[model samples]
Target: MNSKMLQRQLKKLNLNPEEGPVNKKEWQDLIKLIDVTYNEYENHLYRSHNTLNVATDELQRLYTELEAKSSQKIQVLDSKLQNIMSMAPCIIMWLDNQGYIEGCNDYFRQLLNFNESLDNKKITLSDLDLHTLQVRAEEFIKSNLQQTSFTKQIANYYFKMTLNKMVGQNKISILGFDVTEDFNKQNTINQIQAKAVQSSKLAVLGELAAGVAHEINNPLMILTSVAFVVQKHIEQNKFDQLPEKLEKIQSTITRISRIVNGLRTYARDGENDPMMPVNIADVILESLELCVESIRYQNIEITFDNQMTIPAIVSCRDTQISQVILNLISNAKDAVLPLKEKWIKVILRQVEKNVVLEVMDSGSGISLDIREQIFQPFFTTKDVGNGTGLGLSISNEIIKTHYGRLFVDHNHPNTCFTIELPLA
Candidate 1:
């Protein structure tokens, strides 16, 4: 409680050094106030110094943590970008303005079969060692410098290359995409379609087999008769009449050849044949020749109604279209065979921009429940062992390929198959 002691404490506490005289009691009270003030100042100084030390330590730790995290983030981003460049299924390269390879990804290295690092080799369009790339390098460089994109095929492999000019730099980013698998797949699909077309032709031939035999048989009988008459004329010494009989024999042989030729055409493979303007009426008549015999044998009255005398021309594959008409006529023959009053009528006419041919049979009409499904593959109303069910389906596809239509006339009095071909 002494003033001297209080002054010493105040000096230690860095407080003001001035003091005043007073009574003993007052002095004691002042001494107590100075001690309390000194104690508070000392505690505040201790706390401030301790707080600064703790803050400094924490800031150092935060700085170290921030440095570590920033480095790690940068490393991860770099790795991700490198992986993207390497894993891309394309040739990515940066070329200088002089058409020299500046940089390229792993894909480019692997594609061009570069065993060593790119730095070891001076790769340029002028001297690319790869055979395939060398052949196209000059052309590719020309197109790239012109800022044009193009597609090229090397052997069975195809590529689509794009070039982009780098802004603020004398460089171009070239991207070569491999489209070989897609191209090969498309070629495979085309082959399959071609086979399907051939199968359709064979199916048509199978349906007309019996009728074709009967057609050829009738001509054979006429030729035999003409041969016997010519022999009789020669034996009777009828020289004047020999010319007429010889003429008959020639005409009969010609008829037989005509029938055989028609059958041979229908049976030929026409999948690769080019489209041409065909006489629609002549094709119909030819189809009838192959089918009329069998139709007559089934006790079906077969009639051909031609509303157009001049040949109705349509743009189509001649033999394929004939197969379509033959298929329809064969189907009509089979359909009318089961009916008590059996008849198959053929009508040809030109309506608007289309030439229409209709084959109508006096048989039970197609049911409404199955009408929509009739053109579907393997759908038939006939017995299973007797029908392959592909006749109508193949015919429909052929007509569609010709840019025409083959459909049942639902409003007709009988089961009628109508074909509308575009007129040429």
Candidate 2:
């Protein structure tokens, strides 16, 4: 039905557009129009619904395609990263929080002597333990996890490692760099320094050799006189006093033997000398014996005051300790030789848990500015060609190695160098 026909029928039936129809023709036409309109609206709605369905299907297909591409890209990136880690020269590995080995790179596998066939295998920290390679894997992990980055020495090799905390995972990435060659080179330098210090000691002993020979001469003369007296006693048949003379000669010989032994020990060079309990007083006395001849010749009077009757024992290398004392005494002699009244005083005493030895000299005390620099290597106040300037420096190092201290005493009127060693 058309709009004109529907309007005329409604008007003839006296029906308002807003109210119900009265005429039968009006009602029939209205009903027909309603049916036709309903059919057209339904057709339009069905077309719109079909369009929406097509759009929804296309969107779902595009989302699935994008998701697949993203997963592929992620896999490729992961493969590239794994290849880079494998090709790296230094050791790299991923470890779980519980010290389990999650994955390791090629360098790390080679370091542990593992083949590439075990690349997919799950290896843990405990699997690395062996009798030949004593690795405390738990401690290693603990140290690294605690520090985040540190250097570790396993067997003879040194490795510097850095740790990275993983996101959303209970694991750490460990990156290692080998440093054994550099470490060995540093060790070689230290050995050379030790040898140089030993050589310096031998040079000082050479300078005192003449004085030592003179010291030996006095005992030789005493023995000669005692031999003559013994011969005279035998000729006169005076056996009662003969034993006394012989005892005196024996004592002199013993004294000479001790001096020679001390020199021999001081001159010997080796790395096998183990630390032991040493008598500080005896070390001082022996040192004095080595320097006495040179000191007396230079008009320097040296005195040793050991107050304790019992030995002041300390844990140290005996000869190295003696070397330090001799070096101090030699330096004192050089310092006070120009003074009018020259004297070197050595005092040995116990202070609490320490054994202290002070070597005091009459020279003008070291200046305030230079005292701090005196222990520095190659620092010297002596004229050119007179000193190597390493004696005090080496002595300081030796004392430090023994867990002792060598320092200058400023309270004394004279130049006093004090050495304090822990009591044994």
Candidate 3:
């Protein structure tokens, strides 16, 4: 019942469509076979179309499933990120170009005592009641700087705030770290250091007590001699010599007064003194007055070379600066006292924008191995019971606090220590 069979029948009869058939039953059978063959072709086309439709539906279903899974995964990842940001210890805030608070982490909200939900409110920096922070942010936005950092105090706590501008965007991000504990610890350390400085001053005074007594005794003896001469002149009616003798007594008393005043000034606590502009040379000379007698008593030749033609002014606490100088000179005296040369030279000069002071002793330089350890606390080359070993270390710290430097001058031939402070 296929096309081949139909064709064979037509050929057997040798008939054409335009001519009549010779046998009617054979022609009728041929027509029925043709219909069956056409129906079979149509059924094949229908089956192929149904299979294609089924494949398309399966592909669409698979795409939908993949899309759902991907969306779920993305949601989970976003949730994790949010949780992490919320739980972070530091404060984080995002701001718009206009300085309005766009968003913030949970810590930021908690720090500002923001009880209301962020989603329900449009917050700005002004609403936080921190005027300093608001002003700083406004200033930063107006500035050409890309980022800024500063410390801010809130209640009893301190925060180190860092603000970064977003490149190619009108936004800024602020990060705040709590530094209260560090601040308190530093304050306590400063207090202890101050006490130590005071204690060192007292110890130095104690060592110089005998020399100070001798210095005062000389002036007193001169005063007593002058008084006796004045009394004899009065008894003998010799008024002409009285004026000269009285002048000598006045000068001696003045010397004693200077010594007493210098001692009084050096002995008290100066850590809390206000910083003022002072001529550094004057401070050095004043410090020398307190210890010059002691150095002389040891028969050490001390010389000062003042090369600075003009006054070298600096902003500092004079007492503390003087303490550092005296300590250095005292150390220099000790270093060279036993040496054959037995001399200490102090040089003051200006180098560029800094005032440099050098204390050199006529001793062989400190050993290379111990030079590095000299400035460390409790590290000393002096024999036991003779030194606290905190002198150089404290002096170094004091100079650093003044934004200056204290170190050994390796270039010098002998043992030399240098202090370099910026000119105010």
Say which candidate scores most in lDDT. Answer: 3
lDDT of the candidates, in the order given: 0.77, 0.81, 0.85
Model 2 per-residue lDDT tens digits across residues 110-150? 77776645455666645664322123344544563533556
lDDT, candidate 1, equals: 0.77
Please write out the lDDT profile of model 3 over residues 200-234, one tens digit for every residue: 77777787788788888989999998899899999
- For model 3, the stretches where C-alpha displacement exceeds 4 angstroms are 1-78, 117-126, 220-250, 268-275, 350-354, 401-405, 410-413, 422-424
Give the lDDT of residue 210 in candidate 3.
80
Q: Clashing pairs in model 2?
A: none
The deviation in Å at residue 160 for candidate 3 is 2.6
Over 4 Å off in model 2, which ranges? 1-77, 94-102, 109-116, 119-134, 138-175, 270-272
Candidates 2 and 3 compared by TM-score, better number: 2
- TM-scores for all candidates? 0.64, 0.73, 0.72
| Location of the lowest summed lDDT over 10 successive residues in candidate 1 | 14-23
Model 3: lDDT equals 0.85
Candidate 1 residue pairs that clash:
none
